[model samples]
Target: MNLKRFCTRFREMRTCYVGTQVSFLDKIFYVVDYVGAFIVHGASISDYFAYGFYKLRYNGRKEYITYRRYHIIQDKCNVLSNRCLCREKNKFNELFKNFLGRAWIDVNDVTEEQFILFCNQHPILFVKETNGYRGIGTRKIETKKQDVKQIYADLVSDKGAHYIVEEQISQIQDLAEFHPWSINTIRIVTIYDTLNDQVHIMNARLRMGNKKNSVDNFHFEGIGANINIETGIIDTVGYDTHNNTYITHPLTGKQVIGFKIPYWEDCKSFVVKVAKNIPTVRYIGWDIVIQEGGNFVLIEGNDNADHDFQQLHNCGLWKQYKSIIKYF
Candidate 1:
């Protein structure tokens, strides 16, 4: 958004345009189409052309419709900082306390003695910043070896007072086979229609972390694939941030397609219920992990739901919801 950043990005856009595979006319069309979308969304031209040249293949129509332009509208609709409720992990779990088990404690509120006592109960735990994003400020705690006081002290020093000590979730074996080291999560985006007072499952994708990482965030060098909303099947193999596709997981050799998510219907139903519960926050991106026994737990929620995953699916987001999104 600043002058330096803007210049750097514009330079990158021109570089990408030089390397694009599309014809000159097609590239011109892509640029013109993006200029129009920019008028509507004010998105950076660099990102638009970069995505268009590489991923969308200079297809102006898909570039126009698929690139999300609804954030301002979403913020206007979700007037209250109800969106911020989920931004803080402690407040998120507290708001939906009935849906989750007692698996967390605020590190700031407890003494070192009490924290150790709680840690001893679980072999593994996760110390996280209550309001972190993109899997940042998260530390995996192995209770067997690490000293609780040291871990607590480091967390408090690094993240200050607002952090949480949470029990590590065990992802379902079926899903874990793709990347055993990480707890992969399903990202479901839901939109609440204020006119109808109803919620809609806009889109979803399975986000898997690399074998080396513990957190499964799309931004953390992880992979994601589209999920068939109706069938609960993954539509394609995982793709990384670079837009490189994979038919099978590089580390685990697990087949991505035809893999049906466990407790699919239950996850959908529960997310819908949660969405309806938060009336003030109409649009939400829900991250959830399926347990070993086919049950699922809500990992976190995002009110600023971007269409990055949807863009990878090679479909225009607005094509399907033109009537509703026109208001934006």
Candidate 2:
């Protein structure tokens, strides 16, 4: 890491510490989190020992010493990230555009494919919650030809549940080459690797949901499977789009494979490139859309992402994560 550049970034974020300092000690905690590099580099003997409990738990969990493990090691690692939930959508959007360039379609106000009113409108639009998690309140609505009066009324009558619909992403599907329900997405996790102070692609999973399958929220029962970074093929773990057992596809009835994710490398690269630009976010999960024909689209990004799929895949990276909580 370049000390000068890190220092510059650290100083810019320090402005966040300007207000609400009742006293010096109170201010110290606030600044430590905001400017982590300084605290880690210049920690005193007491400060270093303060982190001993966290390090022990995190490191012990990673070592696989279930034979005789201590109680406190896991607690320390769990405290590493400080669980900052304030992912500013505008900040993310700006960072996303910086890396994705024109490839990202902007959806300020409109409707997308799922919500299109008329079949005549072949291509539709879509927008999920800027901060939406788990496919909640996701709508495939047609905004253009809607009776504007009724939609406007909904704002007043409904509980201000706002949504956006843009044109549906269109891509040619190769029937012979691809399977049905092909609107699959790749989930790539990037970690700051606090111990090494380097970024690592921690995990990759495939989230598949087609028009026939509906919503891709894993909690909403969407199928999720692990894919190899070296090769796009799925790992042994597989679940239905609705979080069901590996049953047949309702529309296609094709046997689902426990391990068969396509275009794995392309999806991982798309995420890694975008992540390299967002400097503060040490951890993230990028969702990439692989159209029917096999090209990739940067659908969206997620912070504070889940690790259940990693365990399911038997990839066993949880221990690895347990090993790297010191820096954050």
Candidate 3:
């Protein structure tokens, strides 16, 4: 790892170290185990705390996959996803137009006149960097209220970064009620088995914005609850990066647990079809927003899907994932 990332993880390890309630001897064992794992499996110090490896060893189970190991598996599975056609925002929208279900324009490609027309058509715009992750470099713009010409100029003038402006999605009213300011989305991770030619929905999570944020990204102070893949119902309490837990939405007091996602069966079929579209990228994390009348739109797909969020409740999925991906 680089110095910057190492320093950040070191700080996090220290925080977790201070907060853990284990005895002094157990703490020494934890550090030793972490060091050995870091050297052998390329695991980070934060991984030890995140997966509760300190406790898992005593329980005689070593099935948790670390952050580095997850990337290694992703790299092996996504050999062709490196092309960037599907990962980049503009190309992905153009490539998956049928599934996007929304209008979008690449600021780099459109002229000032064309941009003005797009703004007029879409009063509220969701602007994002072409390759941004974790909801960074994204914003909601009110084209009718702001200076359209200035907005267009600013977007086009940004050097070395491509931006795509999309029509704001009006989410289903039931899901929107939990966080009216943001479009709450479901993050469904899929694994395509090349040998069997089947798509498997590995895990799902309901991501909802908190503190009035416009995007429901877990990294941006949003809350995420584990969703039951079979029933499409949220089965766990909401969790955030700061270790805060919520049984109900902090803003609206809406119940998070047992909330059923609309069009559950359709969502499974839609993602399965989409997964088959790019067989080379076998593992993917798709962010979907359910619109009115039970139709869902594709927000984005992540080739390097995150593992920490889904495994936060002390359940390790290493063995299960290995069983499916071993043939590859």
Candidate 4:
């Protein structure tokens, strides 16, 4: 048994049950999952499960790199199969900044002063690590102060600290028009359907963040809901066992209820356009923000998006995306 290799692989295997099921291999060297899921990925799994994915193997040399999230994201969704080099979003955001136009908060070389100034002007801001996920290092800076430097220090100190500070955009004219703190984001997913060699939008989710919620990620402590793609209305919502939830605003006691996502169509179009630009990545997740005036803005792009939020809720998108397992 190659104990060292087994132990190393065990640490990286995300699913806890997977660890237990395969742990004996560590002692016996059975080489449990050498040729497992097409997309070998690390994700936010409860101790119960971790997701694995991959496209059907074809060709002689190799179709995609092993666990290369950037490479997979850069894959072509078309027959020509053109690709891009910026696997990382900070660079992707920078390279595409001039293309994204003036409305986007200019974020090339970020400075503490510029970030604070923008937050002060915009009322709310989103700070995110470019190469990170699960809302692990995200902070919604609502107010700025001279002590903003400390927050910046803490944020950028993490491993993948390369970040983009964006002005927070709300999604409603009035929450009372639907429900209190009704503003939210829609997660649109596009997958390269390998069986048919086509691209299709698998699912879209609406994530709502109230005043008390730091981030609306369905993982790492945020509230989310499944959205009906065509109607842009939330089919079901509220917190799950993993992401947590509340019946009323825990702080204000305002009720949460059925609400439509603002500017849904435009958000979908932009996601398709940018994913087309990336080309190769078969699966793409786009998080879009809606301004109070109901204008849609692209918040950021996620290459390997967590879709478990789809499954745990039994939102029923598994079959829609299963064929796209070209393992991106």
Candidate 5:
């Protein structure tokens, strides 16, 4: 353990305790529980807070898969997902071309002339770093407002970072109406059981952009709600990073709790096929966008799927996860 980092996190957690109105006795009890969880369950302080282990209702807190344990699972399961084929944006597009459903070009692979043609073809483009996550290093470029030549020059010389430029996706009408500023997506986590040659849909969540942000990543202050895997209906209220809850979108007034995702069965089958295709990468978190006519497109795959957002409703999934993967 890094003592310096631990101290820093403790200080940050202390601020959260006070801000969240945790009483002094409760704070002391939580600290003790946190330390005990760290030693026994390999949980981080943030995991303790994020999983609501400090709350009275979470009596089975030990059943939650904390950050450190999630990493351990990733290490054991994602044997090949860390490779360039999945980790790098350009290579991922090449590997999963059939599902991308859009035109894209790698900055390093295209000449100025080819890039100019790409820009002319798509008025709105999403420029993203090859290995970026959580919406960092991503930009929405409107070709009509900016010079194509300048955009090409900047992309090529942006500190040696590789970028993949792709056409913007026009999401399904209902989702678009809910948050027109960003493309709301479904995050479906799949676990491929090698022993049984089966793909299991472990968990799913509906992520939506809040306050007109360009991305729906929870780290970007977006909201996420639990999706019932079998019914494809959102069953819980949305929650944000700051612990704020929403029954309807604050901006668009769309009801969140009972909204049904379009083409639900197709979405499930789509990811199962993808998971089977990459058997070596046993675990994956897939971001999918529903197109205007109910077709779904792949955004990206995460080998180290997040454990916090899926458990935001104070439900722990460690036992369910273990039963499926049996890694522990």
Candidate 6:
């Protein structure tokens, strides 16, 4: 809520919105959403008028401040609890141990010799931080690379580094055609139904990486589309991190809209099962990758899901999940 931070974030969000062609009407709606948040939280708008206003205000009623208060704090799920399950990618792999062929190892635990051996074991490997986000701390390591040792050292240097070595996931041919080199994944948002004691899929989106980035994160220079939850079909063309639009993929020229996600039912089932197992954290956003044969692998889970990504498509997640999330 610092004044400087608020001004900075306001400028950033406004800039992104303007670049994306967000209209005057939409901007006015953003103001209304901000006022609603201010009144609901029972705090002076000026107190949060800075960074908190810009960061959490516009997405939905259950945005930054509301999300932290209701989904996280009110649920008694602290930062440590969220990280133990969501932030660490390896924890998810272990949590769903039955899903075979997907493996991950921490660089700190393995010796230099073992690291090289692990690299050789897989044709293509993904080096990642156990607690990274936005695909910032990830690298693709090919076995053919000669400088594996130096790369390993740099990843595990004394600056107190933490890294995980994971196997590369292949997408189904149809999905891969959109972005072959990157592992395109489906991001499904879910909330636990306290009343019914069940988990439900609230909404879904498709994230496809461009040729420049290795991972498919919407905020990491990748393209994303809103998904039709019932039909498993992409509802729109992909948009980039900066809100730049794309109808045909820049690299492949493959049509982005109307693409159906394979193994949609199985993916939903797996996520529900996973959510049920982790009962303490009721809110979740899962990143699932569909394999070559349509079987999906769990990439990771997010407790504080980004509400803005859904809003980028000009739809609000809170509107879609109002009944399910109202109990929170």
lDDT of 2 by residue, 1-328 (tens): 4878755543443332232334767546544542342233332222222222123333432433121121122343233443232143434555565533222222333344322343235333344454556767555545465544454345334444443333455433422122343345568877654555566777777665534544665666566666666776665545642233454434455444544555556556666667665545556777766665566666556665654444442433545665564445
RMSD of each: 3.5, 14.9, 2.3, 8.2, 2.2, 5.2
* CA lDDT of every candidate: 0.75, 0.48, 0.82, 0.51, 0.84, 0.70
On residues 104-141, what C-alpha lDDT tens digit does candidate 3 reach at each position? 99999899999999999988998899988889999888
Q: Which regions in candidate 5 have their CA more than 4 angstroms from the true location? A: 1-8, 11-25, 56-59, 80-82
TM-score: which is higher, 2 or 6? 6
Best by TM-score: 5
State the lDDT of candidate 5 residue by residue for 104-178, as single tens digits: 999999999999999999999999999998999999889888898998998898877989999998788888776
Clashes of each: 0, 30, 0, 14, 0, 2
Q: What does the lDDT come to for candidate 4?
A: 0.51
Rank the candidate models, highest lDDT first. 5, 3, 1, 6, 4, 2
User: Against the hidden reference, what TM-scores do the models get?
Assistant: 0.85, 0.58, 0.92, 0.59, 0.93, 0.80
Candidates 3 and 4: which is better by TM-score?
3
Q: Kindly report which residue stretches of model 6 are placed more than 4 angstroms away from their true locations once superposed.
A: 19-82, 319-322, 326-328
Residue range with the least summed lDDT across 10 consecutive positions in model 2: 64-73
Report how far off residue 231 is in candidate 4 (Å): 2.1
lDDT of 5 at 45: 81
Best by lDDT: 5
Q: Say which prediction, candidate 1 or candidate 2, comes out ahead on lDDT.
A: 1
